[model samples]
Target: MKNVLILGASGSIATLVTRNLIEDSRVRLTLLVRNPDHLADDIRYDSRVTIVVADVVKDTAHLTAAMQGQDLVYANLYGANLKQQAQAVVSAMTTAKVTRIIWISANGIYNEIPGRYGQWNAQMLGSTLTAYAAGAKIIENSRLQYTLVRPAWFSDKDLVSYELTQKGQPFKGTEVSRQSVASYLSALILDPSQAINQSIGISEPHTDGSKPSFY
Candidate 1:
């Protein structure tokens, strides 16, 4: 069985990922969240799932210990302390010798995608994405195998489809469902060799063949 640890496990997208992964009896899952009480009851009852309480930026000792013996770590934390949280995860993983990390950033952090859409996303994210860029840098410099996934606007609706592009290509399509993002994250966790040390952007397909949700 593969042991996987997920930070920010209470998040909507993360919760979806957890639910999907839990259906697989062979996977051993651990959730590191601020409040374990916030987790849904069904997830709490699962034998394969373990819950740990820890704040990503503030706590490291227990978090590091919890992460020990895991095969991989998925980090989906956001907001201002993102970079610091990434650094801490790196440190813990480095200490524990857990070398695989999958991080969820957002689209347009690179400024490679052009026009008003990219600009708008950059502005919408504000300083949070600045920290995201720094976090990506830390992952790039670290010894661990990493894949930074930048997803476009996410919604609760179920679209059931998505696409992933290489780092340089502009992410295409409209808002992807949060479930789709979760599905992708779960896939990355299951298969690291295919996605290791890469940055990917994800979005849905559009009728006009142009990526939507730009504005």
Candidate 2:
């Protein structure tokens, strides 16, 4: 069976993708989390699941151990030290000989969004985008095969309707459901080659506005 390791696997999208993988695919999962309590019982107790408790940025030894036999490493993480986390993961993966990864990032990191919404997004997320952009570069420069998924503002909407825009193209829509992003990530688990060595923007079909509808 394909072996997958997810760093920061307790987040909303990561958890959803974790659950979906358990039900829809036979891949063995290794979840790295800061707190085991953050996981659902389904994942916490699954026979095919292995929980590794450690912080992605602070625990290099544990992280390296987790990547040892992993076929794909998916990092759905965030923080002030995201660039540092990228450094740690890259070092560990190289040591373990794991070569493929999927990283979750935000859309404005590339300044690819347009119009009033783009200005607003820049004004709102500029500080956060700096670290994200730096972390993305760390992954991009690595020899590893990587797919960076940049999503629009997130929503809790239970829908899975979404579209994509390539890295150099303008981003679409103002918001996308977390479910849709999870669905996209889940698809990547079965086919890590789908977006190899590329970055893609993902968003809902036509929820464009001055800002995300909820905001």
Candidate 3:
């Protein structure tokens, strides 16, 4: 069985990933959230799930302890202090001797997005993207084997179909379903070799436009 640690477990994407993984008998989960009370009873009570209530950014010691014996760490985290949080996770993982990680970042980080949607996204999320870019850099430079996922703007759609763009390629599309992102992350967790040590951009094929289709 694979022992997986999910940081920021209460977030929307992480919750979906958790649900998908728990259905598989081959995986064991450690859910690290800021508030255990926020989790659904089904997840809280699952036999294969272990809940750890602590902030990954401020609880380095606790995070390190939780990383012990885990095969992989998946972080679904973001915010102003994202770089610091990434640093904390890296330190803890190093201490725990865990070698693999899958981290979520946004599509605009590299300024490699094209067209009107890219211009708008950059103008709107410039500051946040700066921090995300820095955080991605931190993870990329770390000794751990890491896959940094840069996903397009999130959609509420349930579709799992998506496409990937390698590091140097322009990020395509204005939006991708949250479910698609979750599914991709879960697949990576199950088989980390597919995109090891790479920063990938994910989006739905031919959905490229000036803005998210839902808008």
Candidate 4:
């Protein structure tokens, strides 16, 4: 059985991944969330799931304790302290001797989004991308095996249609479904070698435009 730890477990995409992973009999999950109340009863009561309520950025000792005996850690947190959170996660994982992690980041952090959409995205995100970029850098520099996923804007649509772009390649499309990101994350956790030590971008197949359709 594979032991999986999910940080920021209450976030939208993380919740989807958590629900799907719990269905796998061979996988045991440890969910770390800032608020236990943010989780659904099904997740809260599952026999395969262990819930740990603590802020990853502020609770390094608790985070390290949760990392013990885990095979993989998937981080899906978003906050102003993005860089500090990344540092804490890397530190805890390193201390626990656990390797392999999947990090959710933002597109355009590397100026990989092209043309008008790139400019518009930059204009919209501004300094927020600076924090994200700094956070991603820490992950990239870590010795832990990691796949940093920079996804286009999110959608609530149920479809899992999406495409992948490597780090140096231009970002594609305008948006992708949260379902797609969650499903892809589950696949990576199930098979860790797929995109080992690479940073990737994901988006819907043909939604490209000046901006995300939603905006």
Candidate 3: where is the Cα deviation over 4 Å?
A: none
Sequence-dependent TM-score of model 2: 0.97
Q: What are the lDDT scores of the predictions, listed in order? A: 0.82, 0.92, 0.92, 0.93
Tell me the tens digit of each residue's lDDT in model 3 across 1-215.
99999998988899999999998989999999999988878898898899998898888889999999999999988898899999999999999999999999999888889889988888878789988998999999999999999998899986898999999998888889999999999999999887989999999888888888877
- What 10-residue stretch in candidate 4 is worst by lDDT? 40-49
The model with the greatest lDDT is: 4
Give candidate 4's TM-score.
Answer: 0.97
Q: After superposition, how far is residue 171 of candidate 4 from its true place, in Å?
A: 0.6
1-215 per-residue lDDT for model 2 (tens digits): 89999999989999999988986556999999999998988889998889999987778899999999999999998987889999999999999999999999898888899999899988988678888998999999999999999999999998999999998999999999999999999998898879899999999998888899998
Report residue 112 deviation for candidate 4 (angstroms). 0.6
Q: Name the lDDT of candidate 1.
A: 0.82
Point out the higher-scoring one by lDDT: 1 or 3. 3
How far does residue 74 in candidate 1 sit from its true spot (Å)?
Answer: 0.7
The total of clashing pairs for model 3 equals: 0
Error (Å) of candidate 2 at residue 185 is 0.7
- TM-score per candidate: 0.92, 0.97, 0.97, 0.97
Error of 3 at 101 (Å): 0.2
lDDT for residue 145 in candidate 3, whole number 0-100: 98
